[model samples]
Target: MSNSPSRSVIVTGASGGIGRAVAERLAADGMSVLVHYAGNPATAEEVVAGITASGGTATSFGGDVADETAMANLFEHATTIFGGIDVVVNAAGIMPLAPVATMDLETFDRVQRTNVRGTFVVSQLAARSVRAGGAIINFSTSVTRLQLPTYGAYAMSKGAVEALTLILARELRGKDVTVNVVAPGPTATPLFFEGKPQEVIDRIAGANPMERLGTPQDIAETTAFLAGPARWVNGQVIYTNGGAA
Candidate 1:
């Protein structure tokens, strides 16, 4: 891994949640990371600060992942600052739950634009820009397989992401750039705990064989594997769900 520090990554939604964890983890693996946030610069800066404090290489950038122009600029900035891009992680997404029968059209569209369009924009850029031996990782939910209620729109959007990732991996054949998805079960991020009582949380936790919720680091570990050492693990969905499905 002596050549690892020369590698740089662009991680969308690095302001918090799994994205932040990924930024920190990848930086620890000796990669310079471009931490991106959609709205909160302060949070993103904190992630940057933490990495630098630990003697790691990282910086923060902000943009709407759904905007091709903005994302292109983000890629350019990462390449300019880090010398070149090696990996791209599309962790920016929004999940608003509403049953399809009563789901607001506006909310549904917003979900599609941010989750589906955002992943598309980032993955498209990564396909063209990421260096060989790199990886493009997209986020999806185990809910797609679990078929949970009120996740119709969110799951539908991610279904498209799964399809996109699989095909993009093939399209990049012989390019040495791998494409994959990380579908996590109930993770214990603050975002996950929000608005949920202990009973609900416990019930969800008990459903899994792990008998607990996954931490951000759990997902990040799997991502680090794909980004660094798992070259042959291409074009697949690695469910980091503790066998919940």
Candidate 2:
């Protein structure tokens, strides 16, 4: 691995929203970033271009976090392009809401596959590859604490992430690598606003103590901190929810 201060970091789901913000922020902090996306090549390229244009180093790769081969390729490319990775942020997730009685099994399964299993796969790779003094940041949600209706499946998935972070931290005890999770409140993202009426959106936003939904940048800030210079903080789910949770 290169001994340069500019370390390499990977941000999964960097096509848009919080993932994009996190990738850009890390790049701005002088890290060589690997921006991973699932299907949106254009968006991923846009992120990479934005970083490079700003005099930072970044590259975009398209791969499903749930696929083992794709994830292997992602790590290989990261190491090949920017040297060994020092940080990994697992920000890829899906939230499809429905009452448990009415939710389709397929949809629930997909949520778990992407949100829970995807984190597992990426974290596993990071465990084997990230250098000492590095960190793994996983995504959870404040909804798990809120216990909101129609979010059972999503909360369950994040709960799994919380458990994973705790266990992984213990497993990595002597490695100087910290494992943690970030649980954000309702954020103002395309995914959050999709299919929701204005009234419902307003209510959701007002539900939080801050009286407004979070911005992608808000969540990104916490992720950036966890990835660098937050080595003493580990095995904890830091909830950045504007005091809502």
TM-score for each of the candidates: 0.98, 0.97
Residue-level lDDT tens digits of model 2 in 138-182: 999999999999999999999999999899999998999999999
Per-residue lDDT of 110 in model 1: 98
What's the lDDT for residue 190 in model 2? Answer: 93
lDDT (Cα) of model 2? 0.92
Candidate 1 lDDT, 1-245, residue by residue in tens: 23378999999999899999999999999999999999999999999999999999998888999999999999999999999999999999988887899998999999999999999999999999998888999999898898987779999999999999999999999999999999989898877887779998899898889899999999999999988989889999989988897
lDDT of 1 at 189: 88
> How far does residue 56 in candidate 1 sit from its true spot (Å)?
0.7
lDDT of 1: 0.92
lDDT, residue 128, candidate 2: 95
User: lDDT per prediction?
Assistant: 0.92, 0.92
Q: Look at candidate 2 and give me any clashing residue pairs.
A: none
Q: Give stretches of model 1 more than 4 Å off.
A: 1-3
